[model samples]
Target chain A: MQLKILYFGMIAEITKCSHEILAVETKCNSNQLETVLKKKYQQLQSISFKLVINQNIATKTIFLHPDHEVALLPPFAGG
Target chain B: MHKKKTVFIEGAITPDFIANSIAKHQTKKSIGAHNIFLGQVRADEIEGKTVQAIEYSAYEYMAELQFHTIRENAFEKFDLTCMHIYHSMGVVKTGEVCLFVFVSAPHRKIVFEAIEYIVEMIKKEVPIFGKEVFEDETHQWKMNTV
Candidate 1:
């Protein structure tokens, strides 16, 4: 499956792009996606971020689909 | 259905804009108290480099959704007459207001609590990012501390 991954804040800085499309296994979960991303961008392993799937934070190992909007969000600094 | 509120401003939130918002509320006769929280960009010295401004960005779609959720939750938890939230996008210089949260209620206590709750949630939940630009133009991403 092809997933659209969004990068924000410091995560974007490391990724060098705001978003991209990555091809992964059809049955991959959030944790597996994170591992794939870390392998692709080794610097990502050093920062803390959360995986947001379809506008909600993915707190557990949720399965990913092609249509799901996936995002990597660094720590929030809003007020 | 509740209409989505506009939360992102292009630059610093001017005092005039804030005054106008308060002025527009004059006809809300039932409101007995109004509490506001303004977040100002600070010129903090980080490793000898002074912050000159903050360039903010966000996952705008997600941010609007989070703001809407916070607003709905606030209305559910407090007896608020109305509330407004505005945060700066792009660049906001040091000493400028970056965030403005206004909450009004029939009584004073509810407004106070509501304002705090709304501000806290915005800080923790919104996917807004701040890049602190230093005097030399170097930047560092800011993270909210507990």
Candidate 2:
């Protein structure tokens, strides 16, 4: 399965890319995918971010559905 | 359902735009009080580097949804006649206004509470991010303490 991963803020800066499609095993959940990504991108290991699945913050180990849009969002600084 | 207003503006938000928003509300006679919150970029010296500007970005699709949610919640929770929220994207220089929140209500107390609630929600819930650029072109991510 392929998941479209979106990166924002400092996460994007460290990743050096905004969005990309990643091929992963079908059974992988958001947490597992995050671990893989952190291992691949060493910079992410030191940065704090939230994984958003389908516009909502992902808190548990839920399977990644193909239709779900995923994003790594850093801390908010809006006023 | 209320129609969503444009929240993101390119570059810094101009003072004229805020004045125009105030001017557009003259006919709203029922609104007895109006409160405005403007967030200006500060030139803070960090580790001997002076901050020069802020470059903002966001998970735009999600930010829009969050803004809509905040607006709806504010309306339900407060006695507000109307509210306007504008945030800047791209680079906003030091001392420039990046956020302009305008809230109107029948009473002064309501506008105050409503503005605080909405601003806090935006700071805590929205996925917008800011990169603080220093005078020598170095940058660091800005985090909201709240």
Candidate 3:
């Protein structure tokens, strides 16, 4: 499965890029995805952010599909 | 749902734009009350550095969706004649307008309620980010404090 991952705000600073494509097994969930990301980008482990799947906030247990849209969003400062 | 409008502006929102918006609404005689919420960038001292400006960014696809949801809910919950939201996308210097929320209604009460609800939601729910740049050009991410 190829997942399109997005990074924003401080998280993007750590990731050094705003977007990426991840290869994962179809049975995987966001929790496993987080573990993989945290290992790949060590700075991500210390930051506070929310995971969004397909434009909606996602829990760790949500299943991921191929070509799924995922975003790691830092704390919002919008007004 | 109301037709979606472009919410992101390239730079700081100018007073002339605001005044033009107000002028355009003069013909809307049914709207007796209009409440506006403007968010201005502030120069805050943090760790001995003064924030001189904020460069804003966002997951724009998600932000527009969030705005649409908030707009739909406001229309359902309030007696509003119209609502317009404008937010700055790039650098907005200290004291410049970054966010502008305008809600109009037939009466004052509903406009007040609508403005509060809409502004609160935009701050809490939208995925927009701001990088606070210090006077020396060093930067840090800004976090919304609920």
Instruction: Candidate 3: give the TM-score of chain A.
Output: 0.92
TM-score of chain B of each: 0.98, 0.98, 0.99
DockQ of 1: 0.90
Alpha-carbon runs more than 4 Å astray in model 3: none
**DockQ for all models:** 0.90, 0.92, 0.94
Candidate 1 positional error at B68, Å: 0.4
Residue range A18-71, candidate 2, lDDT tens digits = 999998899889889999899979888987889999999998888998788999
Native-to-model Cα distance after best TM-score fit, residue A50 in candidate 1, in Å: 0.4
Q: Chain A vs. true chain A, TM-score per candidate?
A: 0.97, 0.95, 0.92
> In model 3, how large is the Cα lDDT of residue B19?
94
Top model number, lDDT: 1
| Clashes, model 3 | 0
Docking category of candidate 3:
high
lDDT, residue B66, model 1: 94
